[model samples]
Target chain A: MREFALIDRLSQRLANRRADTRLGIGDDGALVAPSAGQELAITTDTLIAGRHFPVDTSAFDIGYKALAVNLSDLAAMGADPAWVTIALAAPELNAGWCDALLDGALAAIGDASVDIVGGDTTRGELSLTITAIGCLPAGAALRRSGARVGDLIAVTGTLGDAAYGLQCWPTRDNATRDQQFFIDRLARPQWRPGAALRGLVNAAIDISDGLAADLEHVLSASEVGARLDIDTLPTSESMMRSCDRETRLGLQWSGGDDYELCVTLNEAQLDRARAAIDCPLTVIGEIEAEIGLRAFDRHGVRWNSDKARGWDHFA
Target chain B: MREFALIDRLSQRLANRRADTRLGIGDDGALVAPSAGQELAITTDTLIAGRHFPVDTSAFDIGYKALAVNLSDLAAMGADPAWVTIALAAPELNAGWCDALLDGALAAIGDASVDIVGGDTTRGELSLTITAIGCLPAGAALRRSGARVGDLIAVTGTLGDAAYGLQCWPTRDNATRDQQFFIDRLARPQWRPGAALRGLVNAAIDISDGLAADLEHVLSASEVGARLDIDTLPTSESMMRSCDRETRLGLQWSGGDDYELCVTLNEAQLDRARAAIDCPLTVIGEIEAEIGLRAFDRHGVRWNSDKARGWDHFA
Candidate 1:
């Protein structure tokens, strides 16, 4: 397929024509009118085959994850997703592959009401860079710098499933139902909108570089510390049955690719935040006045985190 | 360099912290408030090492052009550039290489007052994807679909220099002064702000895919035709001296990578547009009510354009 033909197909199928879109695709630049009094939230992420994911990953999964990761960043900022621009570099063009990729990308935005405004496509090693734009009320963004001492640290949904899912990916075809669940989690990480928890949460971050490392970012940014109870970290029944206690704890703290939001909130707002967030909420830590992150078990034994290395693309 | 360290260095050097920026780098997303009564103009472009440029090209030029190409798109829409997000994937991290790349990128935005708000870094075949966001007054954007039958088609600056420059690129060190000029044009295509032309031009497009092909886009989008004069096509002094008439014409019509603006305006508005646009302007065609683009010489001899193939990424 030619570039124009591919672009036309994408424009027709994926263009989310919203009321605020003055001009969508087929222009030099997309023109969008943000709602008055709302600050635009922008984030970018790139996924490279063989680096960010297995090279054998399906086009559908690649496209889905590419957009999902950017939207997850928007969610962590307590912003409502408004638009996305994708820059795709593919080694070659295949009609069926393009169709599947577009389908998966559209599926990723299911019911989020965000638009695909504009993008660039060229021939290169298969990679996707997606920049997502969202909006939030002025002075209401859930920043990492807002994590105050004494705040209760909470996380949404079960953790470590995606990392466990990677182990089952290669044998996904012959996998058990529980393994299929883990594989699906690995391929398609879920992200909840943080807009509803804007006032309730003091700080928020998406868990992409494992729970411990990401919480460390919050601590550094907010100039505070955290004490995480490893036993309280949420885990699925499938995960519990699939691994030993030590393995489960290690995965929960250091396994990456879980797009769930890890938030810090005041204890008084716990009930309100639970009512506002439409997902499983578990308090696994607390923001402290100290200068570092510490983890402990249910038996009050200090768990050494010195050896827990998080995901690093350049390392 | 580790991922976080590289990120810290980049955040310090390239972040364009504007007053409207509520949050910049270091957060999940950057937050910026656009001025009221303005529409956001967004565009994205990607430059791959082997595809967009030579594999041996310096990181500096690649970085400069990556952002310049996106800014050119914003200029075509008569928008004032405001912010940008960069997603860089490199095979390896080198400090000097990274520093030069950042310097070149900053140099490209000289006096444009645009800011680097957020970005992503990863490991892959070297590639840079920049998404530029600009703003324009509501309903004042120059669009490709706005041409009229009587509009005078015009172009800014000389054409075909970049294509000619490519021929001399490999031996640029031994180039003559004139050859060096052309080489500079190829490496760094100049883009002017189109904000002043917002009220003057009926339609506009940047000449990236050669003049003939880009003009064809305007004709197709406006549902009109054009009569281009082959003899009236502009050429620089070096271009005129380096090639014969036919060679110059071919390069003018079929050669790509000249970031000049092609615009259509009324005869009455021509004087105002010329005054408003900072670069040299030349009229090469006229919009017709007929169905397709046609070219002719000064003697009214029709020039067949069927053989002029435009640049296509897939083809």
Candidate 2:
């Protein structure tokens, strides 16, 4: 059997009626027209085996993570998930594995309320590239360039849990309940934020490359600086007990893969946001007029060196 | 160096300005607002080393061909090229090689009048994926299902050139000027008729999977059938002289990588299309009421049991 034959078989399994999809598989591209009063937001991410994840990772997890990361981007933009197209490359055709991958991905899509529109599958080393399309109300997207000086910088939920979980992967010392929670957070993160912050947040970004680095992205794009209050940065008691203070703070501030939404809001809206969201909201910093970031200790003195580096892709 | 660092380095080279591009390289996703009154048509394709192309192929050619194939998809959809995003994976971070790839890709974008909006780069096995977004008039897209019974099936440019070129790759005995032309076509095919066929074509698709298979896709999607006149299928004089009659006909009918538009049109529009396009339009078949495809030789006998197959991704 050839590649086309494999695709034909796979496509048969994928054939189903979708209301919004004007056209599906077997064309040059999928065609879709957005509903009235909604604008489309599209994002693409690629994951390569043995680089993005371990080769031993299950196909189900790979599918779940690929869709999860893309959905995180949509959440950051304050857009409602809509559609996705996947371009998959694998060394060989394993029908059972492919079915499981699709099942996992479809499960994620069901949770996100997004549809799999169309995509291409080819033979190569295992790699997945997914482009997600979302929809937002007219003039309602929260962009990175909207932050202003004196605004309160905030983050959703706890940070560094995922990084700490990764560290635990090397040594399976503790099989405690808290340790299992952290491990699950690293493996399958859920970015299910409350809808109340949709129009309230001014500027937002997902914490993929750690707090320090991702915050830098928002500040730089907004043409402003920030001053993080070191003591106010949120972390769990389990993370604190597992690692030393310095390591805990470093991982919390610079460790990536948390997938939490880092947002900036006006000082006046802070109270309303705190009351609305189910997850803990911490005002870790404030937007500043300066050109770079600074972290201050509880005593109001600048803590640590200004050369804090987060997870760099090519580092 | 880490994967994110490599992305940062490559991203700097892709940073530039375009009026239509709402956002460029460094965000969760690149955002673009198409011109008013235009509909966006998006397509993505992935090329892997040792699969889509030979590993020894030039990086520049690989980059150029990657974008070209996506552009061919847009052309088949009767769309005006607008923007593209590339997700690249490689085993190593060679700055010079990456620069060369970008240079070739940018050149092709310039020629096609498309903008490089954003992309992601990571370290992995060599693979390149590109998602192309184009704009077309609000309701003028040429889709596969739009073909009607009695519609003439026409193709742009001669076929079998790329297949013959691949045959000559091992032995340079056929390395004449004509063979070189075919080789160039295999490496970098130019899409024909350009955006001129947008409003005129009833149904169209790019011929990347050879005429036999790709045409079958159109017929199947449209719930119609076709009777191809094998003698009417276009074949270059050089190809006919170099290969046997059966082989020449097989290449012309089933050769992949042509990138030419296979279109279906009403009889009334034939004269208008002939006047608009520079390439010769060969009417090789007509849409029938039944489902499936058939071919007839000069003797009016059906040409069944074709052994020539198109490019398959899984084989």
Candidate 3:
């Protein structure tokens, strides 16, 4: 397949003809109109072949994850995704591969409306980049520097399933229901619909680099500290059945790729926020006057912070 | 250098905060507010190590061109560039290389008034991707689809200089003034300042893949054809002095990477439009009812359109 053919296929699948998208696909650049008082939120991610994911992974999963990861950033900012630009590099183009990739990418944006506006396709080492553009009300973006003392630290959805899935993928068993659930979570992460809680949340960050590391980013940015209640971590039935309590806790704290939002707020209105987005959120900790992370078990004894080594791409 | 440290270096150079940019660099995504009555224009480009530029080319030039190429797209759409997101991948990060790269990129945006918003860094084969976002007045974007049958075909600045420079690069023979001029054009292309002609122009496109191929895109999109007076082609002093008439014409017709604007309009207000942008504009052809390119030399004899083979990535 030729590059233009691949681009043509991608453009056709990504076309949505939105009114605000003044020009899309075949133009030198995409033209979009933002309504007055709405601010544009732009995020970019580059997924490499071997470093970010296993080379044997399906194009479908790669495509889905590529856009999913980028959208996760917008979600952290409480922005509604509207458009995406992809820069794709590959050794060669295969028709079936391209089709599967688009199928997964199109399905990834199932409800949260977004149009693939403009992009670049070229020949190179296998790498896919996505820049997701979204919008929010001016001065209403959820930032990492907003957490204050006494705010409740919460997370949207269950954590650590993706990391568990990655560990189990080597075996490729899937004999138990737990394996499938874990793998699915890794391959296709569901983004939290917490954009509605923009004003309610004091600070937010998407969990890509383990819960501990990502939360640290918020704390450092806000110049605050966190006290995580280890026993309060939200876990799925599959997660609980698949591992011991200490192992589950380790994964919850250190396993990355959750793509869930770690949010902080002053009030304990998680029920309302969860209902607003139809997603489960658990209050796992609280912002403190301290300067660093302090994790405690049910007995209120602190867990060693040195044990949590979060995912770092370069490292 | 670590990814975060490299990002810090980049941020320090690219930090020229603007009012509309609510958040930049260190955030999950950049937050920007486009003024009312303006539409956002966005484009993305990826430059592979061996394909787009020589593997041995200076990192500074690579970084500058990476953003310059994307900005050219905005220039074609007649948009005012504002924000950029960059994704960089390299086998290894060298401190000197990073400094030079950012220096060149920051210098490239001189007086263009843009901010490096947010991006990613990863370890992989050498490649760079840039997504530039700009804005234009609503309903006033110059598009390739707006050309009329009688519109005059014009180009900005001189052509064939970059192609000449590229061909002359291997020898490293900058002993002559002409060779140095050509090589400089290849390394640092000046994007035409025709965005000011938005209201006055019917259609516009940036010449990256040579005039013949790029102009064909505009013609096909506009559902029109072009008739070119080959003798009227703009030529730099060095280009004319260095090459014979036939070789110079070939470079003019098929040489890519000029980064100049090829704009079309009907009324003969060339001087006014040229004065608006302070860029030299030369009329070379006319849009016609004909179905394809028709070129004429000084003798009025038609030059075979088949000879105008333009650059194709996949070809």
Candidate 4:
């Protein structure tokens, strides 16, 4: 089949001979042996061509972001991303384009220590569904329901840059260097949480649906609220240069596609947790006994959380 | 929010406290623990509305068949299925219809020892992608490339029943016993190979793309050929009552959606393999030194393997 042929092209460049992967790709399924005393983590996401990404977007960027988002889920759960399966359904396209797409995906996967183990390809609507599997020690996976009162809430890296990217994408020009950074951020987000920091976070979630909305998931699950310090929120220099204060701040608060990890942890673990990631880690909030998320400015005034637009109306 | 509400409704009824599944549906990802010294088997499939099933097919049938096809892949590999992840993308549909789909999928999943681990739900074109993870002892996972010359080729249960169902679906009636039986087979294909049959077959594959084409995959993978006895194919009473012998024979040979296991094994293993499967297991062919699949009539004359319609012309 042409689909299998394309997969073979991707497989030729793969060097995934991990000790745990007794079998990877090319069979009815892939065979893996999880480490003793460790738990396995799995996540799946579907990206539609018109709804999730621009139709004209390069296959390489699409491929990179698809895996990146799934990796973000693993990072949020404090798991080491190990394997992925992609089920791509598309209208008829040039084989060359498919090859480029797979090359881009494999390029991203190669560095993350993730293997393309299994997949299904068919002709239909253009959609990509990916399942990422990861591993962590038993009882050590960072969940969203473990945040307690007074826990320091922190985020790994700047936010809203990707949202800013999406906002300015149509007007992006080669001359707007700062805006280009936002677009690039949207296209290729890095997962800042590494294996070394798995057990340090009390609660965690990936910012796929904006910090305000995703944090609400943590609050609702943990039965606690958070007070975020708006001034202390991390913002990229590019985002500041590209937009006005209100637009920038609004994007920072309610914008989606950040792919950063928002976590709650003990204050004592802050130094060690920050050291584990190369990105700037900012302490944005603290959990409270109250049951709804709120944000406060440096002047000690509450900012309206309801004003920030929620990305996923579905959730 | 409605999607999460629907998921919660499904989750409340789930009693999955598997020691392997530390975390389930609600988290960013699920946490599972595979036993030490066992290999994990992973398979993924994607089914699109209109392409995989008739647009008017019931949500219940669609949901059941989606999981059934993936389970068939696991059965082919002789893997003990353990976990499943579904990424569902659909256009706007009624809440009641969505509930019916989930109920159907859950009903099928409830009987198997598999847990619904993680998934993504979103608004998009209608498609369902499922990834199933299974476990087997290290080096024990079945493969399609292990068949050798002189091995006996066998099949489980009946063939062409689902294909027959599709052919007769337009005329199906609730009161027509044979038609209802065929339709049910199409919707709820049972994976006949249980755990007891694992490691008993040399090489296997689910008969998805018709025996003429799927057999080529095994032959090409194993670097062997097959000579199938056309008379030996297992056909159901429903098929006999519904069609002429020639039509039944043609459907049995070239039709898809059987979900039956077609395998090759040493002649000595026949008794044990048949004993392991409660469904009828019949020797249908033999692996040979020649490099092509040839099906023979009971009179010992070769039937036309090439004239059989290729279900997947992509190959």
Top model by lDDT, which number?
1
Docking class of 4: medium
CAPRI category for model 1 = high
- What are the clash counts of all predictions, listed in order? 0, 13, 0, 2
DockQ of 3: 0.76
- Ten residues in a row with the worst lDDT in model 1 chain B? B301-310
Q: Which stretches of candidate 3 lie over 4 Å from their true place?
A: A173-175, A298-301, B173-175, B299-306
Model 1 C-alpha lDDT per residue in residues A149-208, reported as the tens digit of each score: 999999999999999989888888899988998988888888787888999999999999
TM-score of chain B of each: 0.96, 0.91, 0.96, 0.94
- Number of the candidate with higher TM-score, 1 or 4: 1
Deviating ranges (above 4 Å) for candidate 2? A1-20, A35-39, A137-139, A170-175, A192-198, A237-241, A275-278, A297-307, B1-19, B35-38, B170-175, B193-195, B237-241, B299-302, B305-308
Query: TM-scores across all candidates?
Result: 0.98, 0.90, 0.96, 0.96
Native-to-model Cα distance after best TM-score fit, residue A255 in candidate 4, in Å: 0.6
By TM-score, rank the candidates, best first.
1, 3, 4, 2
**Per-residue lDDT of candidate 1, residues B1-315 (tens digit):** 888898899888865647787778899999999988999999998988877777877878877777777888899999999999989899888888888888878878888878898999899999999999998998999999999999999999999998898887887879998898888887777887787799999999998888888888899899999998988888999998998887888888888888889999999999999999898889998999997889987788776656456777998
Model 3, B1-315: lDDT tens per residue? 877677777777666557888888877888998999999888999998878877887988888888788888899999988899989898888889988877777767878888989889899999999999888889888898988988889898998999998887876644477887887787777765556888888999999889988888899889888899998999999987899998998999989989899999866767677777767788999999888889889988787757666765665
Model 2, span A249-306: residue lDDT tens: 7788788778888999998898888887768889999999997888876777675434
Q: What's model 1's TM-score?
A: 0.98
Clash pairs, model 1 backbone: none
User: Which candidate leads in DockQ?
Assistant: 1
i-RMS for every candidate (Å) is 0.6, 2.5, 1.1, 2.1
